[model samples]
Target: MASRKPQTPARKSWWRTGSAWKRIALWTLIAGVGVGLIAMVALLTAVYSTRSSLPSYDELKSSPNGQMVRVHAADSTVLVSLGPSYGEWIKYDQIPQVMKDAIIAVEDRRFESHWGVDPLGLARAVRTGIANRGTGRRLQGASTITQQVARTIFLSNKYDFGRKMREAVLALAMERKFSKDQILELYLNKVYFGGGAYGIDAASRKFFGHPASSLSLAEAAVIAGLVKAPSHYSPTADAEAAVSRASVVLGVMAETGKISQATAAATDPRTVKLAPEPRQNSVRYFTDWALPQLETLIDETEAPLEVWTTLDLGMQRAADEAIRKNAPGDAQGALVSLDRDGAVRAMVGGKDYVASIYNRATQAVRQPGSAFKLFVYLSALEAGHKVDDIVVDEPVTINGWSPRNNSGRNSGQITIRTAFTYSINTIAAKLGQEVGFGTVADMARRFGITTPINTQPAMVLGTSNVRLIDMTRAFASVGQKGVAVTPYGITRVTANGNVIYQHEVDTSHVLVAPYVAAQMTDLLQTAVATGTGRAAQIGRPVAGKTGTTSSNKDGWFIGFSSGLTTGVWMGRDDAKVVPGLQGGTAPARAFAAFMTKAVAKRPVEQFETQVTLPEWQLEPEDNAYYTAPDNGMFVDADGNPLSEERQPRSDDSEEGAQGDEQLDQDWIDRMTGNRPPAPQPDPGRAPPPRDAARQPPQDRAPPRENPEGF
Candidate 1:
């Protein structure tokens, strides 16, 4: 009882233990930890499930030979390959161990490793790279065999970390679905070696003139080295680099124990014994030009499809060779070949496709200069003017639009044939005026131009940009007796031996009557026989025109023979002047080179032969004026110069015209910063961007003169 009394008295003390508070905190912490554990478990479950459930390899269906492209000559030969298809796909067992080992050793050392990835190899590469730079700033790759295969099958060729993660997932999945041997074989077969070859077998034969089974160790190494950067390490682009890269591959293989050190060290990269003559085969320009025409035929997003085109590989090669032989150092060229039916037989966009992706034959819309005169003359023919009609090639102005002749001075009176043959701009402009700009644009559109065409008279003079394909097609219409056909690349496309798509000559509309086209043809014949396009002489008749745009931004030579139609273009990508050149210079020379070689083994033919000359000249007027904006002015603003009477003045007064345009001026002044300050072309000549149309004709400079001796 005394002890209980003492305990009660102790409770009355002010100092007290905080055990209850401590117990409460302990229970709360335990409950919070249990809830946190549950949340963590849920989050981790979601993460792992999502990660582990990534698309597996079993879901991926290998594209069954995505439409094989058999690039051919007029005759049959495997000129090139451009599809996931195959003529023959050999397994690793079929390949010589040397070649197989070289490829595996160079591409992926641990080919037989965990899943599809080579984690240890990757780690080693990253570690070594970091050690060298003492930082992770180096651009290095850590893709394993599976990753490489996955990327080729599922991704574009751009390097990034997202792509890396996707690659890992896909690689793991791929390993789960395909056997190691199958993955290795597919990867080897899918790799691209330059020269348009797509696999080891194709490359081996193309480069070494032998199969994969027969390649030597050095040759194998060379092919292996190309895996990293095919075009860059190509034997054609840089033989020394190819050899050097090969040495690196061989050394790597030895270091990784895939090949003996002695074998790698003794490998004679220099004595690799390449083919006697380097493979000069390339239809890059031609194929590039052809690719665009295919899009017009089908939906581009559909599975890769074969484009069985009419392109003759031989002609393509010859054209490339000619361009190389005759092209200027800074200049590039394009060539096109079509049949009478409008099937584009061969096309070359530029000398090298890998050097530039610009498809000069299709993507480049150049001013056809004199070549554009073809349409002008065609319009003249359609307007009931015969090839024998005569027109004056004299300097004249009409309706505020005046164009100069390419020859600098007019050649007095000339026959229509003579005017075209000589590329007399003044006469061509006269014909354009007669036909009307609307007529000319209509005619051009009918022939296949998908470009804006000004209704101004100058539109008749090739001011509208046109692609080489459309240009050639228009000229071919004349060759085809006026039927405008859509240019087609693929003649037949088959899948599983079943035709999926086929292209026949599709004549859109009658561009010009046969008689009119024929008449135009008769006139252009004179062009090849004597006009500015005479350089295309293939020891045969070729009727076409020479086009050189203002300031020499573009040069063109388009012509057609009885069997083939071809056009050539030369210019810079930005449409800037290439000083000291013309349509008949680089372009024509290349045309002649390609034509000479192309027609070498073919038969000779002419343009449905005919003779036409100026039968009679038109009568001269009191004040000879040209009409039509593109054709230069044929009459004054009142249309009276060539008519019965001329207007006296009121409306033509500058002040009256300015007053009438006062509203326009006000709006323009407001839209611009303020009121127009006394017009100035020089503020240091920064006279604000101008509306050339609003200015008086005299304010504009005369058209540029054609270069001498084109």
Candidate 2:
């Protein structure tokens, strides 16, 4: 009886009632609507924030996606084609119909009909993403051709919600302003195809060795496939992968009715032929060095430009070959050659540019060693000291440092010219002290050494670091008759057939007096003629200095010849010492090799005659008083004379007397036009009393530690 009463009144569950279910459905609908409103507000906020930073439509329309820049050598040889390699702009109608079809078929099927943002394409992309989740398949992108144009022109390929919103907004704006054909043209021209190529024309040329206008269906399909993944589908990178992708592109084209299935089947992807990869030449180093100068010379414009450089291709090739042939196997070499007007004619940054792009000629800064002595002697001459002025080459202390010669022995008293020719460290140190280290540093700066110079006693021995280009420019000043020279590479820049920039030659700023330059030139000539830099002699009137750092970590030969100034440097990038590596060896020989070819066509020119100075005399009691030998003979530390047969022929000579006899004969021959017999001394006046000044100084302090002996 109780069960029957309960059954009669048993009510339906609340959730099962119609009113309860209706309430639940109503709340669910409200929640979904609120979320949609929130998303709409967030999207609007993102669009509003992105609109302000967008570039103007006019700017986008006027500017080409890729602009070409060409650099030409002095001989009009193309040195490099910078930016986009295609200098000619391709118009929309000029693009092949097959190319357009291939791109549209694979990239956006509804490109002709859909707006910038395709709703059907977006829904399909979302469905694809949902299906591809955790399936290890790439999700499809729904960006229409117009949207791609908008993104490529005004936005980066950053995958984020905000960027998408901005891209959508820009796409709508672009759709309103530009025709579909115009958008398609921009996308075709602006898209990158890897291998330093941009645009369809460049890609076609780079991959097929032909223009886009001549592309075949197979080629078009291949290029269209590259738009998805340039590096992966590049014919140059992977021929098989590129062909496979092209086959897929052809299938898509056939399915989309852009091409007949029979035509797609007849076209063989394997028939695609790729052009040979371009060889990377060492001349790229020079172009790389000169490229940055463009920004400084001209305004930032998207127009194609032609840069006429001062580079002499012949000389550049010679320099590259010289560096390759002369640089040590374990070391790298760099050479920079400049005309008297400071035009950079040839520059080799390293033995192989492909191995390393760090430009040693223009970028590397290393100790110049005795090559830096050019500045020191120039300073001495500027300070009222003549080339023939007496300077003690004996051991001396400066600021607790004693400087010694490369031979670890002193030549005692010697003329400034003779000391400089021999690169006597003690004499250089003494002169630095007398004239002031600050003065020496200032002289280097005046001569175009832009790097910071440390005003220290050791700096007199070339302990300061310097760039090869700067050092070459300094010596160029001397070759320019004391006029300051600023090294320049670009001669002129033109755009749209209009000259935009031209280099002006300025020789009004004088770094040193003409007489001082002449005197310094004489010293440098002596150095290359019979001293440490003798290895650099190219059977021409070349003048330069040899530099060998303390540990032989760096070797340098900077000189001028036949209206050309060149600097050669050899060393390891890590500054590791190279055994038997000296400035007079590899670097000097490289200079000779380079100059022999660099100046082959130039007329032989003579340097300005040296300025003669009054004969210097010293008091008999002065410890620095001494005389040079009549026969050009030099004595060793033990007072033993070196015989002609025993004298070193290379720069390893202890007293830098390798070619002294030859130099003496040359001077005599030049003066009289004939070699004369050596004048016999009057028994040398009792042998000049054994040169008492050569004796070890008993009144001086003990020798201090000498670093970086010259």
Candidate 3:
């Protein structure tokens, strides 16, 4: 053999006399050495590449953890977090052998020895895939716990080989970056274990209702099973699947020498019993209703911000419970509550948020029904009409318009207070006709009514639509002593622990006077104390109105206490009316539910609406005199009520103030919102109360026939 090889060294050139076999052997040896050197360089390069972004051992081992956003209750318990998970970080010496070994055995048996990738794993996966060609029983995962942990921390939700490759690459890098114990700690914190729980700490509390340090073997198996398919193998969702998975993990723990075979076989089937879940979805309904309004804060800001609000989560839950419990069997309801300062404390969009996201409190615009009468009556009280002022209720027509009471009967000669208490339509129409329509319209605006309303007399009947939030805000103004406050959800906005913006209270000054507001409050109190709102009465002197729209399409009950104001609206999601359902039935019931639950142990308070009442001035005469028309009072040349007679002797209207109070209580209650019809006098004369109207008798003709024409 030595004689054969030495000949090659003797002849250095290709053309020199050397055996062909010797030249071939020399070339093969050189090529093999070059390939080996190149492979070594490549392996070193790949290992270095992954380690570039990884932190050092000291950094991983010594640092304390922190999070991005954490929510705290007033008492300071962490309510929630959107941040890195924590709670379980044990040193290898302290970690349970079974848990640690199960993780390694079920995930990667060669974990203790491999730098990162295992050549045997790749070959086995390829073989398994080929064996299960079409039936789809392929067994493919060969990732070590390190690789899996790497993917969870840095990878996207997308599933593909590229991510897997990146996981393996990062794993190798991480091996160089951190020790084994550090890698395990990172893995524990990096993965998503489902149920909205992030770290082992949250998971412990979420699944076992305890801390991770105290988890039992049974509980440990449940957590171990979640590593493969969290949602599917959840003890809560599929106990059977979780049991099977846990069994497998247990077997691996024993086989891998992490635990004794006796220990593995000793696990009680009952050990993996799921923890009872509480109502995890808290205030979701209120937040859903508030989302659109919350978006407003975002629009007004420039940076990523966190919103802090005045929301009383307890009150929110109460409101939601009330609406849900009292909603009609087939109907849904919404409730909105606001503070006197216009801060929204709670808002329930519907009976259930998961069932539907149509936030009726903020989104649904429905007819306010008799609730609109609050504005109408408030206007009447402001225009110098007493709550006890007399108003007529008759079968008279104006411009062929006739209004009736809900009971479908004309109220005969009722006081303005009585008509309002009763919600009589005919009387309200007459009041609307007497007070100028514009007066009522202006009062409506002052009261914070934002919806577009018709100026016609029928508008007093609540023909326009209003949202529950607007109703809550408008009522909040009443509670705020006639100062309209816009209901705002977010009170303070912060970013990265720095307050970037804060909400300034907005007061829209309304009310003709403090006294004017007080008068309206008094009427509403009487409404709650004895009228349609009797159902809403609490131990306190709450004031509010009840509204049942035409055709019963919308039902509303809006009320307010000293510090809180609420509006309840009930109707079909569609505009179609639900028969037999009205404000008194559903909305009032909803309000009652909330009040009964909310007012417990709270002291009652009286309303401040007395300021609105004028000094108790009595009418001068019980039998006030009216001048005969055509006497220069409020008559035409023919001494007849001018309007109807002048319209080609039309039958399109009623002659004279045919309805009653000297006025119609219905009209005043309605506030037809006009300025008391300009205090018309008989066309030819004034009344006896004015000294025979200056003696311009019925026989006399006025200088100007229609000087104060409508």
Candidate 4:
């Protein structure tokens, strides 16, 4: 064929006549066009593939929203609501006109004119995005109301080009299938507001504590403004931000002719009063205490649950008020009150549950101070030592560790009962050393103090950390006449009126002998009546101990009334020492105040008393350096009378004068078989005014336990 054409003067075809570069350029253009068409088809296919199956117009006639789970208190009173959906659903007709207008003004100005997909809005958004690229500013959104409704009903909250394309297609379909009012109704019912609220009605109730139809102009503006970003514009989370957003909404409504300029000016978001956060859950601490037990008793399920607990609302309020009234101003405090049977009646973990959720009563582990001495004393009684047994309160060292009395004044060779009453650390430490620290730790564990304990000698003075709940449990055991019980909060749990869990009456075991418990009660009563815990006296037979750490870092008062055992602790979270803080002061007063109110309806009963061995018969000549005569006077090893010389002395002495009077003894020579002689007293010092030499300045009370050379 080419040869025949050449014979006719070589008539060239279109491609053969052109230059090589021109032909190559033409082919490249044709190929580019073909590839572009293929890409267009592929893009269309991808967009169609990504489109989600949407609900028909008939399906959107009714709202299909989630329901919330409500939490009830012990008294069957609705305390709070907990679930993904909060508050109630609302109908489109019930929505306030001001709220809807504000939403349209700010979110979609051309909503009425668009067919679910607005080209003008899209162009404007694209231009804005281009202008803000790499500027760290949020990109402008171009989604119409119908598009938003489509996405909410049929798509996830993903933002991308493909998702946008799919949303556009769905929005177009929605416009053709449904009316504008129908789309708006679906959007209003499906949109998410913050605080677990899902719709306009829920958001109105959750934040403003009212129905959507009852919204004021300012409130309506605030609710509409939250649609942009629920968390960012939450009224409770950021009031200023919410108010600012509301102002912007009001301005938009004014500009869009939805409201007059005067109306917008008069509507102040600051004047819009939201509900006071549902009264702050008056018994929130009780709920927190019962939640763990509630979880443990029930199986995992999404169904709503109701729990009946042992919390006494009156007692809870009293305890909260007392702690807030008496706790150190700069420190936090916790209190746990239980019935005699170990049922939790009241709990106050901190001053404000909303501010902090840490359960200090059950979760915090702190040194119990002298409150731990109760264990040491109980161990001594268990080890065959009577309450009246004698223990020297003189300064002594063991394993290079020496502890002192809190008063810095040692009453030499005092009775055990007396030592316990005064909270003497030296005697407690000596008793702990004598009874074996291991024995004390075991005793604590047996009494329901499940917290870890150390066998160190210092543990006798309450150096081991323990929880307030455990201490309250141990004290309740004593009040229960030796029966140890596990503290519990939930009494019954019912789901849909069917009892799922009912606390089998807590079985109790004897942790202490009846006689020992009675004696301990007596000892603690004495401590409250005439000793360090005097502030805890409630005009009745009460028993307790006062605990103060070395640097005032912790102060505790654990005591029992006739029908309840309560523990209170006051301290700083960072363990900083509180000035002038003492267990016998704020903590004891708090205990008494709480008890007075908690027991207002109950009658007072006497604590069971126990009689121990007589003080005189408790001694059996167990030492060689000291002897207890019939008159409770001490005699030296050389048969010399030292009663007048061995008097209560200042705790600062190191082999110095025994008391205000200075006296020395002269013993006879053993080689010559001569008798020992008593020495004369110094006449220069006349008794040192009794407490003058022993007492510290009023402002400088002796350091707690007079820390042993630390």
Q: How many clashes (backbone N, Cα, C below 3 Å) per candidate?
A: 22, 0, 43, 0
Best of the candidates, lDDT? 2
Quote model 1's TM-score.
0.52
Model 4 pairs whose backbones collide: none
Of the candidates shown, which would achieve the greatest TM-score relative to the real structure? 2
Q: Give model 2's TM-score versus the native structure.
A: 0.61
- Candidate 3 regions exceeding 4 Å error are 1-282, 289-305, 609-710
Model 3 Cα displacement at 380 (Å)?
A: 1.4
Which regions of candidate 2 fall more than 4 Å away from where they truly are? Answer: 1-63, 85-195, 199-277, 610-664, 667-710
lDDT of 1 by residue, 614-700 (tens): 211111120011110111111322222222132122222122222222222233233222334333233254335434332223332
Residue 411, model 3: lDDT of 34
The worst-scoring run of ten residues by lDDT in candidate 1 lies at 622-631
Better of 1 and 2 by TM-score: 2
Report lDDT (Cα) of residue 345, candidate 4: 85
Worst 10 residues of 4 by lDDT: 624-633
**Best first by lDDT, ranked:** 2, 4, 1, 3
Taking the tens digit of each residue's C-alpha lDDT, what string does model 3 give over 60-148? Answer: 54443332443433233344444444565555565555555656777778877877777688678778788888975635667777887
